[model samples]
Target: MTTETVAQALLDAQVAWAINRLTGDELPELAAKAVDDVLAIAESTTMSSLADPELIKSIARTIAATVPPSTAASTLVEHSAEVVLSNPAGTYTLREVVDRDHVERITDEALGLTPLVEKVLDDLTHSPMTAAIASRFVGRIVNDVVAGNRAMAEKIPGVGSLVSFGTKAAGKAIGKTGEQFEAFFGDTAAKGAEFAMGRLNKIIIATLKDPATRDAVLEVFDLYADKPIGRLDKVLSLDDAKRIGGLGQDVVITAAASEPVLKLVDALIDGFFTVYGESPAAELLDELDITRDILVEYAVAGAPRVFAAAQESGELDRVVREQLSPFFSSSEVAAILEGR
Candidate 1:
């Protein structure tokens, strides 16, 4: 009731906690129950010792450090950033877990520690294990702690959550059956994708608030628009990759991004010449609008035909004149044998 009594009660409470921990029962019940009890004690006294903001944080740090982390639930709850934000112990313990997990462990325990959580989520969402699980059980979990935080991400402000989701997805996806993968897409099979388009959409729409992102998002949608409608079809169709080969493009591009796209682009470029003959090359050249500055980049990118076109169009000389002419003496065009 009184300040001294409340302070003494808080001290006693903390002592009891430390004693319980030290005696080695590792009282799961006591530890778990303490989470609620401590909050209650703080609320009851209006400003008990445990209620001291500074003290509360300090105790939290201690408890988290002292707690066991081998279990999945512990990793999910106590070692995560969401918990760390609740008190000092959580913050310190989570930071420590993150540091340790980084050097070697893969840090699965500290799944959601930093603003970087988004990036981790994105990576893990594609992780075969997480994806396998999410592909199977995502309807139950993907939407809130999974999907909802996508909206809350900017508020958290970083790439961590997205990366985490992706890592989880990929890891889970590996072991999963086709049924599992289909489930993750929630009937639409959105690339069987989790955070990429979602987070990207969240960001672009929030920033542009118009059809500005419409094209970008549509491009992503187009990727899977025809490939396979469900995970069952996608998995079953992988065999078609060897036969049809085009499916290989989808597999390579969607399974891994950017790098795979680079490979696909290279393959497509090679295939254009290999399969379609020089006709495709002519078609591509015609499709290119040499009139635009954009064409210059493709020209400079070292595509053989693009360079050839640049030379024929006289743009190579123009490009050199525009970009390199300054380096020359500029008095006159040097004749190859004139100097000799």
Candidate 2:
């Protein structure tokens, strides 16, 4: 027959075979047999395979070495760097990435805008470490106050003015100007200051011992909790962003390229190859239950979907055309067609 006639005859036979066999009752039985054969072969192979410990160990070692932690970390870093370089948004400033409102809220929460501060203070003061530190501080302050009172009692009229002047000068030198000290002592410094110091010392001791003092301290902290010290908007500029981004890139690149890191990479590569090369891969595969079962199950479950997709897209026709088109002109295929 001519080439065109042969092609036409093959096409006619294909259509007939598809209609007869594909639509027949034998299809389900064929499918069932295929599944059973696959399962049986898998069970026999897998059971024999996993019985070898060395194979299991070797495969485990190979897999472990193939994806060493250092290598994985380096790969991740490289990928991250590449992504950052490619994306315009990656060049965002610290200010852009940082939510000032969220930060302010966090600051407020941490500083105890509400009862949070009191709870934190209560926890800290109640803890042995904080209590011990506070106790030591209180003891030192009490000692100094007591000593000062005694000194004042001995030389109340004489050196009081000198002490006051010297104290004010020291405070001024430190840029404090004694405002806080003045506020604490008030006019009491002029009116029986020694009596005031003794009472203040007693008050300090009482405050340390009192539970209400924790709440009082927290309440005081809350006053400054959400108060903006400076403009958050002007915190980071474009120049600052560029500088920071460049510096970060330099740090990451430098760390990755360091001699220690290179040595680590070499060591990891060498160790992995050595371990994997000497491993019992097949025996390891035997012990592990990673069989064709999962694939088979997926195939069985997804058969209807596969069929629907193939029917919808004519994928089966395309595949058959692609694979069997050349074979149609072959003598063996011609003989097979004649027999059919």
Candidate 3:
């Protein structure tokens, strides 16, 4: 045969061999060997060398920019809601989803953020608006009490006139005193409000730190765990779901494009790299609980379906031939064939 004919024959034979190996009982062995080879390569390669930070950031930006249609978002939300509503609440109980130890750990971690909480409370309590609100709240309570007293006094026999006159005098005096106090000692009143707020903060912090707080959380979880999940569509109409989905998508798009969020994404990537950059890819996979056996198992399980689909679409032979033809048709191969 001519050199080209021999090359074609060799390519055909190789493709046939590959297809047989991939589709036959030897598939599992082939998959295992492939995984082993990959693992061997991964054992020497660092994660940092494989991942390009700029490329990842570019991909994120591209995804953020490509906003799906509102209808698509709505459909996604509808499907997700349907899936969620189909399952009973008992399908995922607190114990099944997370252990008590995890809950305790999370609670402890939250408690460790007391300084951030304190700063937020300090800002809220010390605001001028807070003092004004406190003053209004106190005034409302006083008015309510006075109104109650007046109503009780009116219900009594022959004491209504006397009590009404006394109450009016007391109310006028109280109002005048309040006005005078506000006019002269506004700063002192604000300080008092701030002091009350500080006390309130202490109470809140103490409540959060209490062991009962954890118990209360657990109790709430216990109460919810057994309850059946309600049909979300009953409460949230399709229109509402669509609107919320659109709004959420818009928010995500905006946030993803924002400088702060982009910086945060970069920071997270950098943090991951800082921790795992020098680690071998195989070690990283091991750390992630993905063993070689797991990889091989998944590959063997998934490859058949994928290969079947490709074969059905008539792409398998084309792809195989495309890959093997290059080697078979190379100058060195042709020269060797000519010599033969």
TM-score of 3: 0.73
Cα lDDT of model 1 by residue, 174-281, tens digit: 548556766665534544444444454355335444444444544554454444333333253433433344443344334443455445545654554454342323
Q: State which candidate, 1 or 2, has the greater lDDT.
A: 2
As a whole number from 0 to 100, the lDDT of residue 233 in candidate 3 is: 65
Cα lDDT listed for each candidate: 0.44, 0.54, 0.79
Best by TM-score: 3
lDDT of 2 at 70: 49
For candidate 1, the lDDT comes to: 0.44
Better of 2 and 3 by lDDT: 3
The C-alpha RMSD in Å for every predicted model, in order, reads 39.3, 16.9, 4.7
Candidate 3 lDDT over 1-340, as tens digits, reads 8999999999999999988887778887888888999999899999889888778877766665564434566577667655554554533444666676777688778877877897888788869788567546666877799889889988999988998899889879989998999899988888877876776677778887787887887677677765554566668776676667668767876787778977788788788888998989899898899998899999989888888788889899899999989999999998898887
Clashing pairs in 3: none
TM-score of each: 0.15, 0.30, 0.73
TM-score of 2: 0.30
Candidate 1, position 274, lDDT: 54
Ranking by lDDT: 3, 2, 1
